[model samples]
Target: MKKETFSRVFPFALFMLFIGLEEFARFLQGKDILQVGTHAIYWIYPVKAVAVGAVLIFFRKHYREMRLGDLGRPTQTVASLLVGLGVFWLWVNMDWSFGTQGAPSGFNPNVFDDTSRTGMTAVRLAGAVLVVPVMEELFWRSFLLRYIIDGKFSRVPIGTFSWASFLATVVLFGLEHNYFLAGMMAGAAFNLLLYYTRSISQCILAHAVANLALGIYVLQTGQWRFW
Candidate 1:
């Protein structure tokens, strides 16, 4: 393998491993270590985003050499808008399946009562709207999905569709959300954005839009169950 390939793939691997370890630690502790007090959950959002962002940036040269922009090809402004709408529609229409089945059951709503919850919520919402999109799109769309098709990932034509890659990424993505089908759908939608515009940015934007919408809806409606 080329040095560039190794460099690019290494940090990507490390980021995934770091996330896995962090999440496992949180699970083992049976609490959000990043949560401040009882009702605040955003304290760790920046840490998480910065950690991953640093990894991606450290490998920035290699990532750029990999032709990341190609993945965002055939860009269409309308496609982005449509994706946003489609995601919203899915969330609205699939309430029975995604709402109940995908919703968290164990957390107390009072967790957000603490004054710290405001800062945490704002921080987390910012990460969702800003940091998460770039981090995830680079990993899922620009890297793993394409890497699954070929070790020389950049050579794996943009907009290329492969069932194996699609399903594998979706499964991994779903697993990250505790195997929820709603998470699976979210993963699938991100992939679809890649399919439509061949742009990783579009996927990121769509995801950010979806999450932002959900976050606002949850806050406005006091539906902490969805959080």
Candidate 2:
């Protein structure tokens, strides 16, 4: 692919690759390939965060669509924040039977004792609220959404809408989450926000807010499944 495409896709791809590796490690444990005492699978989160976070930082300058100035308007900024809070509310409540099943062990940092748990949880939370929003917006919104509108994605205007791109992004984004319905709701909300403000930074702000709220909720309620 082109350099622009690589810059946008690589971090997201690397993040997913680590996720795949985590699952593979779980599978191997289930099959007795790795003894329970020897398995350091939980470390995968920090490692994944650092690796993908580094890539995102390296390509930060390439993300022209993520201009922080784009979010300068008060009305749009408030709207994005409200939409994010609304999506977070919907997300926690939408854990219905139809949603994908939660992982059998949902990122429990408590597996390690106090200090380690706190450290791991902090890393995970940072990854979710910080790195993830930027990475996902770059991939799901800045790249794929526009790419679906045209192969020459850089040529397409930011937030340019089409039924095919909108619907495809909505469905695929939903599938990316365990809470499929909530994911779809969040995807639609973000997509609409993009259309309204034509700003990737706005979507990132919304996403970060949603994740921050979810992280607080999980910590408060010990709802590891939501993390």
Query: Model 2 over residues 1-227: C-alpha lDDT tens digits?
Result: 88899999999999989988888888889899977642289888899999999999898889888888978899999999998999999999988877765553667666788988899899989999989999999999999999999999999999999999999999999988878878988999999999999999999999999999999999999988886
Per-candidate Cα lDDT values, in order, are: 0.65, 0.89
Q: Which residue pairs does candidate 2 place in steric collision?
A: none
> Over the stretch 1-227, how does candidate 1's per-residue lDDT look in tens digits?
67555655555565567556554555645555444343233234447756666766676666553344543544564676567667755664454553343335322344655775666677657766776666666777777888999987888865689999999998777666532565677788889878877776667667778778877877777765555
> Which number leads on lDDT?
2
Task: Please give me the total number of clashing residue pairs in predicted model 2.
Answer: 0
Candidate 1 — which pairs collide?
39-111, 42-120, 71-198, 72-199
lDDT of 2 at 34: 77
> Each candidate's root-mean-square deviation in Å?
4.7, 1.4
Position 54, candidate 2: lDDT = 95
